[model samples]
Target chain A: MGLNTRIEAAISNAVKVGQAKFPDNSGAVPPRLASALAYATAPGGARIRPTILTSVAMACGDDKPMLADAAASALELIHCASLVHDDLPCFDDADTRRGKPTVHLAYSEPLAVLTGDSLIVLAFEILARQSSHAPDRVAQMIVTLAQRTGMPGGICAGQGWESEAQIDLSAYHQAKTGALFIAATQMGAIAAGQEAEPWFELGARIGEAFQVADDLRDALYDADTLGKPAGQDDLHGRPNAVTLLGVQGAIQRLKDILGGAISSIPSCPGEAQLAEMVRMYAERLTPVVSPQSVPGE
Target chain B: MGLNTRIEAAISNAVKVGQAKFPDNSGAVPPRLASALAYATAPGGARIRPTILTSVAMACGDDKPMLADAAASALELIHCASLVHDDLPCFDDADTRRGKPTVHLAYSEPLAVLTGDSLIVLAFEILARQSSHAPDRVAQMIVTLAQRTGMPGGICAGQGWESEAQIDLSAYHQAKTGALFIAATQMGAIAAGQEAEPWFELGARIGEAFQVADDLRDALYDADTLGKPAGQDDLHGRPNAVTLLGVQGAIQRLKDILGGAISSIPSCPGEAQLAEMVRMYAERLTPVVSPQSVPGE
Candidate 1:
């Protein structure tokens, strides 16, 4: 199956398992919450993180596809859960994501909070269920997911940076954006019975490139074109690559990062194919905007 | 060491591990979010959940003390995280808990949200780290923690019931109150290399009894005595045992449930000691106030 299909299937299966009726079939996941899990995830955006994970796994010779698949689902779920929480009133309060109402907008704030919380819990649970296939791998993946989802270096830490009075741009970007991408690559290796350390650079480069690209899009494109609110960093007085590095500089940095990402791929059976995939992503990622079209330029 | 001491140490260690500086140690966790995690868990209330977990683990011959400690920390962290979210402006909006300001009240709402998210992630990470000690057991504990923390039958589902137009009281109480207690017993058993099925009854009964007792306390105790708002369930128009069954009826039900709890202790090496612990808990849990003390009685 295709990568998106695989990710979609795995994610759907996880929600099914989580929302399944009880032993006595008392009820099904309190209905709305069960549905909300699906609601928050469907029509997935780009499926980029899991795609990177699977690509790295294949590059490393995915000996256990099941473990790799679980890792893919796990990584994606953490990403999705972070988005849900990031859009909450306490945070971004974003009403639209990928052109659809945010989870909190579609569901109430309470359910949205629970939805995010449930998804985070379910992400770990999904990996744990695969322990029968490879207990050690599952354990490591759980750790990776948790590390990339939480503290000093995870997405939450990324979000936490916005609240800080003095933000460390590198640490903030690393935790916020690079952490999961790093998880994607490292977990992919770990799941495929490969070492995790070598994959770090590849993930970090790709993650940094994506963040820069995102800043570029937000800076250059209008809401209708980007499909979500643009110039949000400026609007919120938040830091961004475009703000730190002038537009041209940020674009140049994006190019440099993406170029480095390809070369950073550790030696693997499918290394060539992984590099090609990265190239394809780099093409798709960089916004196709003209200098004349740049807003306020 | 005493159970309380063990629980306290385990919880403290887990937070310390989560907040520890990274390798090469450039920057620590977003200081505010890290501190909020510690702030939210300290001066803990009864700590009934983790206490029950450790007690059960001991009862079943905790051959792996480290695993049991991790499980206790994981379960309590989930409980603490839930309380932080539960007190958010969107949910219960509780200003104070156990006489102190709630996490959100003390920290900003955004920090509170990230703090809760971080704690939840940390809970699973705690269990996953135990994988090196006992991979299979750690995996099971992760699954157990996720199941009790999330959808279908977890605390999240319990909270979901309140949002529904038609509530299922038994299911509500089971998910909201009993889920973690069930997790405590089952995880304790899993940690000790015992089957999880047999311990469910003891946990459910204890949890049910606690919910009912909580209702009684809310009804009988004043704000000064409770150290938090009194009559919150009634004030919120929430469903409670006392409301469902008259005060006397609920009190009787509490007694019956606690009695069943003691009897339900799974046969194990520490069975007698476990029973004594339950009996002691029963005494501490039951409100000592009389009918006259119950306002509007």
Candidate 2:
């Protein structure tokens, strides 16, 4: 199957596992919650993190496709869960996400919290279900996932940065956006039986590039174009590449980061292909950069 | 170590795991979040769930003591996480837990949300960290934790019920309170490499007894006695055994349930001792009960 198809199928299967009854025949949850789980995930967008995970696994020889699928789904679920919680009234209070109403906006705030929580638990369950097959790899996968999802260096830490008065730009960006990318790459390698260490720089670079691209988009596009609140960094007086580096400088920074990401690919059978994939992501990431704007691809 | 010591240490170890740096040298999370996580769990009241887990594991011969500790810690973390989230303004809106300011009140709503989210993640991470030692047991532990903490029949579902106009008392109690009890018994067994199915009834009966005991306490005791708010069920117009059965009937129900809990202990190496523990728990659960209130104890 194609990468996208596989990732989508795996995530769907994981969600079903959660929606299904526990093995001991416990009671079913409320319908609204089950549906909220679906609503929080459906109409999927770029599927960026899982795609990176799948790509990294394939690059690492893809010894265990099932493990890769489970890891990918688990990573995406964490990403999705973070978004659900971040959009709460206490945080971003975002009205929409992925161009639709945020989980809290669509469902009540309580369901939103529970939904985020259920998704987090469901992610671990997805990994555990695959454990017996590859105990060592699954164990590592679980640890890698947990590391990237929580503190002291996970996305939860990223959200916590928002509430603080003095923000460390690099730390904030790393936790907020880079942590999951680190998870995506590291988990992909671990899923395919590779050491997570070597892939760290590649994931970090890609994450930095993505964050820069996001900043540029938020700066350049209107809310109609961005599909959510735009100029949020300026509005909140938050740090961003566009503010510090200027438009041209930030775009150049994005290019430089992507270039670093491609070069940072560790040796593998599919190393060349992975580099090509990173290139393609760069193009997708910088779609607004015209031929003259970037000077060269 | 005593069961209480083991549980407290394991929980402290688990929280430390969340606070410490990831192995890959990522940025450290904010201190406030780390502090909030600690604040949410300390001065813990009862330590009831972990104690039950420790007892059950001991009853099952706890071949892997560390695994038992991890499971106990993981279960308690989820319970603590639920309390942190449930105290948010969107939910119970309480200001205190365990006789102190709630995590949200002390740490801000955003941190409380992140603290709960981090605690949930940390719980899985704790189980995952133990996977290398006993992959099979830890895998089952992870799944059991997930099953008892999330939907379709976990505490998240229990919370979800409040959002619904119609409440199913059995399902609500099972998900909200019984889920973790089920996890305690089942995980204790799973930690010792025993089958999870046999312990389900014991956990369920114990959970029901505890719920009834809780209802009786909430009805009979005042806010000072309960520590947090009292009569919350009545305040929120939520369902409870006291409302359905009256105080005497509820007390009687608690006695019947605890008696059933004692009888439901699955045959194990420490079956007699486990039964004694349950009997001891009954006294603790119904402290206000006079000798005449529960005859032939």
RMSD of each: 1.3, 3.2
Model 2 complex DockQ against the native: 0.69
For model 1, residues B127-191, the per-residue Cα lDDT tens digits are 99989898989999999889888988899999998889878877888999999999999999999
**RMSD (CA, angstroms), candidate 2:** 3.2
The parts of candidate 1 lying over 4 Å away from their true place are none
Interface RMSD of 2: 1.7
Candidate 2 residue pairs in clash (backbone atoms < 3 Å): none
Least accurate stretch of 10 residues (summed lDDT) in model 1 chain A?
Answer: A20-29
Output the number of the lDDT-best candidate. 1
Task: Give the poorly placed runs of model 2, Cα more than 4 Å off.
Answer: A23-27, A287-297, B287-297
DockQ for all candidate structures vs. native? 0.76, 0.69
Tens digits of lDDT, candidate 2, A1-297: 888888899989888877876555444558888889988887777999999999999999999999999999988888889889988888777898889999898889999999999999999999999997899999998888888788888899888878787776667888889989999999999999999999999989999999999988887777777778887878777788877887788989999999999999999999999999999999989847554433233
TM-score for each model:
0.98, 0.96
True contacts kept of each: 0.78, 0.82
